[model samples]
Target: MISGVASESSSQLLPWQQPIWQDLVRRQQQSGLPHALMFTGIAGIGKHELSLRVAHWLLCQNSSGQADGLTESCGHCHSCQLWQAGSHPDFMVCQPEDNSRQIRIDSIRKVNEFLAQTPQISRCQVVVIRPVEVMNTNAANALLKTLEEPAGESFLLLEAERFGSVLPTIRSRCQRIQLLAPSAEQAQQWLQASGVSPDQASQALRYNPQAPLQAQLWLEHNLGEQQQQWLDLFGQWTQGRAPLDKVVAAYTKMELDDVIHWYAGVLADALKLTLSVAEDQLLHGGWLAQLLNACGDGATLNKTKLITLQRNVQEIQGGLLSGAAHHNKQLLNESLLLQWRALLQ
Candidate 1:
């Protein structure tokens, strides 16, 4: 429970947390409304919150479905009360119920049942599904069937990480709204206020609020195990004896998403070693120095090689989007390190 706030239900959100509230309000007020909406963004970015607010708007007795542009739910209204209490029969929120880390068919089946009914307050019934792409084969099919036919005035809201992973059919049926990361300065101030130390604040803020700023702060402030994830790869990539297991295990910890950070630290150090940059204040100066000794670059790293590192980072984002792993992660990392090795050669 954040201070001075209600239970912080997924629908009520900080203004900066989501930038599209007014746009949503405008549509609600203007009476242009969709039967289904898809919200996509990083975790903790108020996807759930925004969806709830939309549900409230739909259920609001006074709402004409115009985008009021007020960017808020009427807290005094009956719809808002039911939503704030999470007791609205016409309102449903679904997420993975299984401890198995997947949103299974049974949960979505329940959503189908909920949508089949009429709204208690108004003609509109709102259903929200978080991490919606987790729907397995059968679940996705069940949802596809609903999308094909008319289902009264129900509005289905889904929040997913990889929007493309959702069935193309489902994507076609719903309008999508994307939320992005906060600015660096904004993120930095948020992290610091949350108690992150000055040394760790800068790196921690590089990722947006929804990207686990607090977790990154914890990792950076403490002498935690960042090396274990990549040390084996670093060792074997140099000797060319690196087993697939070493690379895979390292990647499982670091993941393709995190590759750029490692490169950012290492490459920044190489710049200093080459005298291209002053030594006083590298972000990861200590870690940078250590990687340089291991990778062996005297001064400015191979500019040609740094380009390859940049490319590898891009590929990681691509791999996540394409749902491809292993080969892509391995090829990207090993390929970049091989470029680094060439400088030593």
Candidate 2:
């Protein structure tokens, strides 16, 4: 079965989303809300959550608007109660099934069926299809039909990380809303507000630049310590103070994609240091000095080696994202580490 039936409601907008939210509300108030909207942004910037907020607002039965000129759903209302309970008749969400990345034709077909129905509870029916770029050609084409002839009071909210990745035909049919990540300062503030320690917040941002929510999740998972441990081991291995096999074994126990990403960050920092870039401009600026001291020779890595390693990490990251690393994760990790050792020579 196609996954993603219900959306968790968001009561507040992320700080960075205020302007976009206001613009959307103005359009909504002016009766200019489009039948379809495409929200595009990098991951963890709250595109999906923003869509849910808008959906909740659209589904809200509250007649009395907020005094702040922003309209939010009153949680006590019957429509909202139904929405929160995940049994709202007028709402549906389409996404990839479990263990899959691509949104198949079956899901889009279901969306078509859902859109064919009239609103049962509210003034409109809403469907949210996230990461729309993952839809296969057949699925995209199927969705295009619904976009072309949208049913009465039916709205489609589509999300994708890369706007250019979506089909042109589909792009033309929807109003595009692009989301930008918050500044580092803003992200760090938000993370601190969310109860993460200042140091942890900074480290998380280093691991996940411009994406505060992702950084927040990283902190929640207590992966910051894991990252530091991995970096220390990596430094030791690169310095020939630790065995490659043991380092690889330790990494295999962690999330491979994150491990690769952190490794890429280390290489990037090394390149920056080699080029005499300011420490403040570095991603791992706080821990970099200590890390370099630990890395020894790895810290003074030439730009050529660093760039090559960066490219290798990028390829492995792409493989992970494309689901190509599922079965060959061990091989991929070993190959990357072996190449790291080779570049040290």
Candidate 3:
């Protein structure tokens, strides 16, 4: 039952999305827009925002009749005003309930009912469902009905982090557009423009890779110093200079999923170093050199061991994301730290 109208901020497009935006605008202008569209990409690459922007354009009162060749919404129109206030009658957003992973059948049923009605103000009705991969089978099946027999002038905009994870039936019915992460240079420029310092921006990109929005979030949270401290502790633990409990204590303060992601990045860098990967190619290259110095050298960092540790971390991450329950968090962190310590031993 989580349903709401998109805010004005959601209508803004990211710079990297310009090409896709232009193409969609052309399709929309030519009356070639699909009844159902699914945007697929890694999280934080602006899939949801792009979808909402299209939704906003579709619902704008001035969009259809504009002779000025404008493809964007007029923000001051009555429809845009309603949308900005989160009370738009013709638009809806469906997502997982708070603190829940799955969007149940109940929500999709509401979506069906919402789309069943005529457009109250705008010329069309639009519904946005994000991370559609999390919809349970019943929920997805319920959505399939709308996709198969779409109501007049109604558009369903869906987003998923992984296209392969979406139901095959859902995929076949929707026009799929895959968004790509921005290049490192483009990401750093965006972060810097957003007020992150150059060095901080670069470091965040290293930690987050091609995901600029996520890198910006990393900077906003001021996690760079803490991340470095965690890396140093990891280096000490691997060298047997710091106790395993000490390292685990520091890491447990963060969410287990985040801790594991950081650990995986470290392992990835170590594996790269073991294979003589150039420094520029490493995700956490800044810390790897110091880590190798602390531990001995590349000779001590075994490639096979790093791969095995990465697999273990990935398994834990997958379980955590899948909502697996009954995990003993502290013990799990301890076990992972012990595995890291063994790399040096």
Candidate 4:
């Protein structure tokens, strides 16, 4: 069994988590903890973080229990120390394998073995399975057995961005908590606290909306800069100033999904401009001025062609991210970019 809690820094519950925290505490007090729980929310909203927080609290020996209604672990406790050291025997985390990106039968078998044993440190064993939907059919079936009749004081914490994709059998076995994005005001505050400037935070929020963590990553990684690079390259390719081979090579080197996301933003801005929509409503509003200055107004844009390209982008992104065993990704990406280049003409 792979044993450890999520990193200590990200395991603390956020301000937006108060409602769910209080609800879980009340549930624990009223009827004890559920054997299995499904933490469902949009991607990058800290669902995994919340799961880690719960696991830490449950396994912490010096924790403020249901009586005190705390949402965090006592960091000084031996259990917490063991967790921080990444050797807590009672805590097992299962995730998709590195290459396949799917939880396989082998991992689930280890979970079964782990669940059969008694807790080594705390009174309970905590198991975290992230993106539970990534479990293959066999792996999901294997897990269903444990969820159906959980043995000992074991708790299953399953995090999923898409609850519907999880096996219905597994979903039925666990108590589900549907987490929502924090309000705009709360998200903005969190962004500012993370050192994002007011203007940039607003732009990120506009770009990503409901997902503060994703927006933060976008800023931290300077994805905007990367997007600009792609935009400029595409423009050059369209104007016959850059070689298509090099452009394709550069695109295939970066993450395809992020490139697709950036393409979607660019296409959306073009669409909005074509329809004479307000600039403030554009997702790439921060880059709108430069985009228009370089790419010209959307007046001459072929809406049908843009829509077709957008659909192709989605198709390519979905194909690449499906975690298949093998694919001709380079050729596929090159062809897609060629199509996009043609559309620019």
* Number of the top-ranking candidate, with TM-score as the measure: 3
Q: Model 1 off-target regions past 4 Å?
A: 1-6, 17-19, 60-71, 121-123, 192-200, 207-345
- Per model, state how many residue pairs clash: 17, 0, 0, 0
Which lDDT tens digits does candidate 3 get at residues 216-316? Answer: 77877877788878878877877778887788788878877778778778887877777788988987655677766755644365567768988988887
Which lDDT tens digits does candidate 1 get at residues 1-345? 101122325555545664487777667667666777898877644576677677777776666565443345556677667666767667777776644445677877888887888778765877777676766677778888776664788888888878877878788988888877566666666666767776566644432234544445445544235644464466566555676556655665554555555655555555556564655555444554555555554422566666666565556555444333344566666666666666543
For each candidate in turn, give its C-alpha RMSD to the true structure in angstroms: 6.7, 3.3, 2.6, 2.8
TM-score of each: 0.63, 0.87, 0.90, 0.89
lDDT order, best first, reads 3, 2, 4, 1
Whole-model lDDT for model 2 versus the true structure?
Answer: 0.79
Model 4: per-residue Cα lDDT over 1-345, one tens digit each:
354645687677888988998888777756688899999998768898889888888899876456664455778889999888877888989986655667888988989899899888898988998778878888889988899888898999999887877788889999999999999999999999988899999878777788899889889898778877887787776656788788878888886667676777777787777787877787756354454456554415567887888787766655444443344547866776676556543
Worst window of 10 by summed lDDT in candidate 3: 318-327
**lDDT (C-alpha, whole model) for all candidates:** 0.63, 0.79, 0.82, 0.78
The CA lDDT at 311 in model 1 is: 63
